[model samples]
Target: MESPRVEMISNSFVKPKFISKEAKKPVYLSPWDLAMMSTHYIQKGLLYALPKNQDFSITAFLDDLKDSLSATLTHFHPLAARLSTVKQQNPPSFSVFIDPNNSPGARFIHSSVNLTVADILTPTDVPLVVQSFFDHHKAISHEGHELSLLSVQVTELVDGIFIGCSVNHMVADGSSFWHFFNSWSEVFRSNTISRPPVIKRWVPPGSDPIITLPFTREDQFIERPSPSCLRVRNFHFSSDSLVKLKAKANSECNTTKISTLQSLTALVWRCMTRARRLLPDQETSCRMAADNRKRLSPPLPETYFGTSLHSVKATATTGQLLDQSVGWAAWRLHQAVVNHDDKVIREFVNSWLKRPFVYTMSRYFDASCVHIGGSPRFDMYGNKFRLGKGLAVLSGYANKFDGKVTVYPGREGGGSIDLEICMLSKNMEAFESDMEFMSVVNEEDNKLRIF
Candidate 1:
């Protein structure tokens, strides 16, 4: 398929209406944020269809959006700040401190695309289709210049508008990211902000040497090698199929019932491992991000922002993963989830204090790995920016580097799920034809239920 044609109309920065009084003071990055400093920026995009007879003016629409963004930034002022390091200390330390004198505003781009809404909605190559809507480069260099923690691109099409946003991972996780987006949408639609985020940084009590010192290290920023032949394909599973899978998983063991996530993840892991054609004893694993907001003692507020997440991995030999039933893999995943409690969170903090450096999970990004991200709980479909019902499509631009798997609520809503899987182009071809992998998918031709 040919790349979608896009033309940049304008580029500008949107500053806050008025910097908050508290933003004048410098705030340190939390331990969680420090740990995630080396990762790539998080990006999300949404495509909204415009009514056929709707009167549209690009200039007026952009003006309204910029105005609302400025108002929204008053509450989320930190996003307008830049990352700076303290040079007075023995080793320079980095923090997201605002210099009231010169704050780097968020980047906003207005562009025009030749494609229509139907072109995006129709079935096509997942990676190319999604990447065409993204305005900025995938990677961000945080070392040299002032960092704009948040950037937005609004692309206008004949039948729709594509809104793309990029946020530095150090500023927020999935939950926090959505909180900002929802708040912006609320402000744009109703001229009012939602619940303001809790900006207080949470630090464990103790003056231990490790706890006080910064975790930044030059080696921690080493970039991972990008896969040479990566490709993305999307698969959908209906709510009924998930229920059947959960029931089948539960039938394997009487000790505990497996959840839909666990069953689905296990199925994906098995399929990916088989498609890769790894050795029998090759190590294979599935890694998922677990939210630690409620798991912490003195649970973080619902509005608390920043990265309050931890990774959990379920592992087995490729032979075992392939030879075992889906129930067996689900049980393993279920156990991994059970293991991440309050104690585990505390232990993770303590461990980070000791090591104090950012690093990728080597096993989780390996060829045999299947990394799961995003969650069914997020309200992806409800993000209406005063426009009509907007459909959110899973973008593959961010996860195209490795064996990444992103999960989102299906377009039909209800409890159904859509999984966007990324892998080597050759393996994807084999995976698409795998009978076991195809069994659970909701296909257009096969209408009969397998169970």
Candidate 2:
């Protein structure tokens, strides 16, 4: 079966004509902010060889992108027009354009690299190549007021050339990015854009007769990051394991209150703690973000952009989590999730930025990291995205985007959730092993007996 490299773009199957309509609200990012955030989400340029059709021109394709972005710029927040900055020695921070006058939102760059098909598939230096790329990007910390996002490069050995391009996240989310990409592909294939993007900004907290802002004094906090013992890793499970997990999750709660995500997360916690032999004494928690689109009261309009979700945490003393049956832990997770709502998320953001100095206190905060549970969101289009070179965990939790790691599938069936765990290089194997074992425990009904 082929993955959905190119597919129809719309809410349904129908092609859209006329400039797409977007909600008119002032909630979207300023050009500058968009530039910085884009660094975090933009996938490095993908290298693929389409049939050498006569219509394909990398140069023309770029010109079309520039035109698309130029037309869309006026719709973004003015602040989005600014660039991100970083200190000279910091890990690659998200990029910021140095020329403030250069107009907000830069067009993506395209370049090419030369490599043999065999070299890309089995080059002994691939891991080193990947690791070095990540390391170069890590130096992007901001000092004083400097900012920088990574510039991507692709080396196509077969073509014996390279392609370089950059995308800003503020202008688009994963969904929007792919939307833009697919549109670009359509242009390439047909030399005609069947549909131009609909640019809309949905601002929450709609203007009321009485003055009301979405957040109060207690709504936001900025703190320096603290140290953490929490481990993060991603691993893949067999399709059978997921099926078994869902079935077990359903049966565990008697259909009263349980979800597949909740069940698997609780199960993972128990298995990992057991392997470390710390299940008996440690207090561990599982944190996941719930999409607030359908969960919020009055539900925010689909057009409303910006942060729309908050973290939900489930916990158990090491003993309770490890000793209790898996269903019980899942129930705890379900309960915590049930208790969550928009108000709680609001309070969290408000509280985080409460004190004027709180935002500057990132030097003091600790033990507050969130570990997201996986969900179908990772399936970008129902097809699993095969990881290409220079890729990091595409959507792990960060202080960005609802301040939690997101674990949705890149596209539906893009491939099952890559429970791939990322960590400092030294810990990668250990985290991978833990995920592998955890996946098995969730799969076999009798496996728990061994513990």
Candidate 3:
């Protein structure tokens, strides 16, 4: 049970090759960015299989990756800069910009572990050793100025190489995080980046560019140790299951046909509520971050960098949610998602500016509330790293708590989806035993159960 241990071989910072004048100025944090200040740093990792025919040199590979990262940072300079507090203004403001003189280059770490790729992937649940692959595990996004905004770790496994990244949640969401990951892989494979990042921060016009929080101390945002025993498992919903679920939901709803994502969200939310054994009149809710790239009046580019999203939620009584058909639950969620338009987005941001509301872990700890994160649309397996086989696996880590859910694109690359769900250990057991939930996510085969 205690055989694998991670050995730190090296830890260093890799600075940008060059920084443009644009990056020297304060890259202000919008309301969306400030909203994530209290959350844990984003943890993402990618593993690639080592080819059988070649004898790889770990030293040579590390040198090559550092070189590529240096060039990558030249364009993604905000990631190389500090989290700044501008007290010179009437109301103190927070921004991230490269002082050039005081820049702490993005962290680069190299480590080795005595486990094979199979050892990490063969289990139904993530192995404890897997969390060690990432950096800044216990840190929060508020410490961005004090620490590396972006940290990467390369772990040498017995039969593969794992690249783990820790990005400040205040700096990027799931979309922007993958954008940087994709660009890095491109730079590593070829000396060119196809989609250069648009590093300029986005603040809705008329909205204040600079945001000051209600609290100033680091203790306010740091994650506290939880006594709850949480368990995480990724349930792969095959493309076929999605089709059937969507069809069933559409047939039940007369208003609008529910999307694949909505159908899946409904099923999960309903099942989770049922498993929690909430009271008939108990309040239950679920939220997902809506992408504003295309929803804004002057739409943003999908390639736009930084956080551009708003949290919208659906609420219902436990009785209402469970008594209704799956299609009814899906429509409730769909309405929340579709009704959140440009007006809704701007209004929510402005309201937050007036109040400076920050999310606390306690809010998601509610047994009746579920916070959905990430999207299946993200290209998880696209990090080829010059190998034709692409990535063996990629997963999120470090920020798990009760009721936190993340969705990922299935490795098979079809319409398939995977939900990385976490809950209190006892609740997780009950969730897995729910027959209705298992119908859409049956563990009848290893291909669906194991990655």
- Between prediction 1 and prediction 2, the one with superior lDDT is 1
Ranking by TM-score: 3, 1, 2
TM-score computed on alpha carbons, candidate 2: 0.59
The digit string of per-residue lDDT tens for model 2 on 211-272 reads: 12222222232222332333443344444565577677667667746766676666665654
Using TM-score, give the best candidate's number: 3
lDDT of every predicted structure (CA atoms): 0.74, 0.39, 0.80
lDDT of 1 by residue, 1-451 (tens): 6756778889888888977678676556666777665566777877887655457666788899999999988887777777665543556554333344476588898888777765665553453655655644555425313657787888888778888887877678888888898888888888897699887666676733223445355554545435577877668898999888888888886645689999999989998889889999989989888888887878899788777888799999999999989999999989998888888888878787666666454523566778898888877777777666676554625535557888887767789998878788888888888898798998752222111
lDDT of 3 by residue, 81-117 (tens): 7676654353443343333458668999999999987
> What are the models' TM-scores?
0.91, 0.59, 0.93
- Candidate 2 whole-model C-alpha lDDT, 0 to 1: 0.39
For model 1, the superposed segments whose C-alpha errors exceed 4 Å read 88-101, 127-129, 141-145, 207-220, 361-364, 445-451
Error of 3 at 332 (Å): 0.7
How much is the lDDT of residue 62 in candidate 1?
89
List ranges where model 3 is wrong by over 4 Å. Answer: 88-101, 214-227, 363-365, 388-397, 445-451
